[model samples]
Target: MSALDTDRYHIFGVCTPKDYCLFVDYVIDEIKNHESSLLQRIQETPDPALRVWRESTALQGTDIFEIECVKDRETAQEAVEFWRAYFHSLGETIIEAGHLCDRLD
Candidate 1:
């Protein structure tokens, strides 16, 4: 079993059931495949009603797929930076650079 960190980040928002399902599928695949694209991960939780995630790697729980990356400090920083840039590129007003990112060690 992969160890997960819960106090790293928080992902939450609004989206639809279909979107949430898609998000979950995407997340499962990403984690399974060990894909490290912060942008894709950040946007995995699509749009519709409500969706939330974080950096705890616990997105494998609850509804509306969440991405809480619970990695070590070193690896976690890299993930956070990647997501920060991606979130900025997405131009998400609510999801700022550090929205789905964890503070560096």
Candidate 2:
């Protein structure tokens, strides 16, 4: 597949359930307020760019959230920056963020 077809861009990390709930709530608010273009796109599209799940571990389960899109680099960058800023505004430190091309074929 062409580089343009790659679903490489993603913002992913693990966080506590409390922080995860807070983050999800913030995104839901943005969607309701129509305040974010990236989020609106995800909401409107048949295929979403955001995904969240929980994984059980030896310790307490961790909430993992990933925002990704199979679109152009610029659009992906915008989504990444939007989440980065949002997390920063909430004083939430991202454990990892960036294009995750290497994680796939």
Best by lDDT: 2
As for candidate 2, its clashing pairs are none
Candidate 2 local distance difference test against the native:
0.39
User: Tell me, what's the RMSD of every candidate?
Assistant: 11.7, 11.9
Compared to the true structure, candidate 1 yields what TM-score? Answer: 0.28
C-alpha positional error of residue 3 in candidate 2 after TM-score superposition, expressed in Å: 8.0
Worst 10 residues of 1 by lDDT: 20-29
Tell me the tens digit of each residue's lDDT in model 1 across 1-105: 433433433332322333332221112123323333434445453432213434332333233334454335555455545554554466542322233333211
List runs of model 1 lying over 4 Å from the truth: 1-65, 68-70, 94-105
True-vs-predicted CA distance for residue 48, candidate 2, Å: 30
Q: Write the per-residue lDDT of candidate 2 for residues 3-28, one digit (tens) a residue.
A: 44654444443356554432322221
Error of 1 at 73 (Å): 1.2
